[model samples]
Target: MDSGGTDIIWNQFILGAALTRAARRVLERDGEEGEEIRFSYADTHAGGGGLPVPALLPVARKALASSAWAAAVGAGDVHPGSWVLAGRLIAALGGLAFEADVNDLDPAAITAAKASREGGWVRFWSHDWFLFLRNRLAMEPRPHFVFIDPPPDDPRGPGYAMDAAILLDTLGLPYMVTYAVDTPGAQPQEAIDQIGRSGLELRGAGLERGVLLGGGAETVVLDILSDLRNLAEVLGGELSVRLPRAPADDYCI
Candidate 1:
């Protein structure tokens, strides 16, 4: 699930891939009728542009029409065939797709996605992810599953508190999967604690560390929800529960 980069942005893609796979299994269990799944990636990068797109696309294409998933991707200078591959994947899985970026994307990217005739099932937007989520929630049921891989807010590097804040606020939703790195003196557990203070329960946490000789520390996945009353009481902050859906199930690549 490594996003092929060291930064947290790359880590988000790793988390996205894991969550997408988990959601796919959950969707498969429902027998594929009257079920709708939406996958969102808040940030986009050239190096890892195609990472998260493939996971949900394959399932979507099999379950739905290519146009159903292709209409949602925004136009941008994404890698060649990125949107088409994504549409094909979504159509195969019979699902819908939505991708947004804080920064605007190249029109050619949007044009390619539209040209593929997947625009009905897929669409792209250039906007803040938090706002997009908020708006979507107002119109639809809480996404059965959500992957929040916002950019990190480390002061030493390119991080954004607003992204974390938005996610923290949205944690009230039923099921969510998020990515946070464990830097020196900065543990993602603290963020989990903060979210707990706001009344959400932390379900579980998984670690994604560098295994190579000289690679950096690992990124951790904090599975959260609004349950586990006893654990929350004992911990005095936020308590994490280990569901049947263990991080190890999809944490590895």
Candidate 2:
């Protein structure tokens, strides 16, 4: 993911859209149960919120023109990062949602997140991604949705992948994993294989022009997948849903 001063690429837009849709789904599902369903969110690599990413204006203008959240961005000079976008969604639900645990390895990013919020819908954390996950493991009434957007050059990518599997197995909370893809179809497949090898099933997966996303088992992910596919059509990009391949040894014997 890009830093606060970097240009906001297309991937951020896709991510914001996915988070928006997923949070809305959580609201719909949990709204009926009253206090039984507490909406919680976490972003492992949340960047600074409400930074200007001029590259995204054209796309954002098109995709979010009808969205009320668009006004939050003002004149389109600034864009919301995944955490801010999710926070906006939670804010929309009034006071029903729990304050999200938004963390970033960058202290500057954490500061930016803190500066952008008008209310207490989000909490900030400055920790290594691995340590952050370990701490969140003990959180009661686990996060309803966790967003994992590791930096492109992050050395802990492999470790994060492994930990993600443990997170799903142990907590059973849904997650949305997004990464940059150099090739059209290469990265998404690799993500599926990695998740499969980790012994978790994909709830939904999609490859948009420059970004790939994989989800854990939840209906919200399904909705997110559908929204991405629709966005692909609007952008004249391709969206492919790949199934996780079973372990080779499982079928060999």
| Number of the top lDDT candidate | 2
lDDT of 1 by residue, 1-253 (tens): 3322222222232233333454355457544466565543222211223323423333332332223223333333332233333334444556545342212134554444454443434335444545444555554444433333333442422133323333534453323333333445434444334333221222223323211000000111232122223323322323433221333324321
lDDT of 2 by residue, 43-96 (tens): 888877765655435664567566444544446456677666666665665535
For model 2, what is the C-alpha lDDT against the true structure? 0.55
TM-score of 2: 0.68
Per-model tally of clashing residue pairs: 51, 0
Please give each candidate's TM-score: 0.38, 0.68
RMSD of each: 13.3, 6.4
Worst 10 residues of 1 by lDDT: 210-219
Candidate 2 clashes between residue pairs 3 or more apart in a chain or in different chains: none
